[model samples]
Target: MSVVSMLTPGISMNSFEATAHVVTQLEVQRVSYMLVGALSSNAYGIPRATKDADIVVSFDSIGVVEFAKSLGVGFKLDRQMRMETITNSIRNIITYTPTNFDIELFRLSQDEHHKERFQRRQRRWLEEIKREAWIPSAEDVVIQKLRWKRRKDLDDAENILAVRAKKLDWDYLNHWTMIHNTNDLLKQLRDECPNLDVLDEE
Candidate 1:
């Protein structure tokens, strides 16, 4: 089954509206952030259900927390410096009580791949909310997830590969995957998605 087929839920407009609101607020406050996770995945890959939107920001937790709190009211910062399981990277998670939506903020890392992905984010029309927003590229999404190596991340990577193989920058993807030791997993994802033949040229 394709990613859209295996995932049985539709995206929530309310979640997107909330994201747009927050994104606008962040920009107004001069915070640099790029949308990641399934929320942004809707751009190039299958639209999957997710309650939260993950963002990589140029600021750290301290700056992000202060900004989140000043956004009128109801946005609560839950945890700061929370380390993710597989990647061991720290994130600041803030929840909007009114919508129960989480915005997980990750600090931009010095890692080559992270820097590249953050710099490569492009503005695209988000159909979910009918607005343009900065979103990670399809290749970046796969690269980000596969580096994490979690079960769900793997599924997400596979899903992106299934639908966006031809569109991805294979050279860029392969370079980082080899550095991150995920080349085999990348190969497996391509193999699983039978139609992903673009990599065969390499």
Candidate 2:
């Protein structure tokens, strides 16, 4: 298990309470969702700045329309993007005007890798916020960051590798990276952050 002492944090998120508040709603609705993106990366890697939260949910029982209502009034949702890449999902965004905290929802897809990652997710208590959160496994988070390949996301990937390389499931990571053709990228990250590969002398 991963456990780090909380000596405050360097991450400056727009709203952690709003993120936790929405997570409570997802739990109440019995929805399967995992926190991804910068907010989540901050937990695994280094704490930095994050504007919004990315939650991938299976909209089988709960939809964005309903989730928006739970977010209270003045929250606008953008149900645009007919079809996106990989997951082939539309952008179902719920923006909380009070804090400008946006929760971008991606409808679960039948993609094999996504399914695996979703199934691999685990819930843990976040002591910093005193709430439980459904977070992607460390390995999956790293892989997704690489797949996204945004400049910030690539940075997140490197940071995560630097911090979590010891705890990460190398077998699982290698399997998916090879499938996604990101094995080279993974190797490069490991090269740059060589300490990530240095397991304790145990």
**Position 27, candidate 1: lDDT:** 69
Error of 2 at 104 (Å): 0.6
User: What TM-score do all the candidates reach, one by one?
Assistant: 0.82, 0.84
- Please, what are the lDDT tens digits per residue for candidate 2 over residues 1-202? 3222222222333366656666766776777888877767777777777777788887667677887776555466876744558667566777767678787887777878788889998786654445768788878889888888788888888888887777778999999999999999989888887564453212
Candidates' lDDT values, in order?
A: 0.73, 0.74
**Pairs in steric clash, model 1:** none
lDDT (Cα) of model 1: 0.73
lDDT by residue for model 1 over 90-124, one digit each (tens)?
78887766678887888777666778887889987
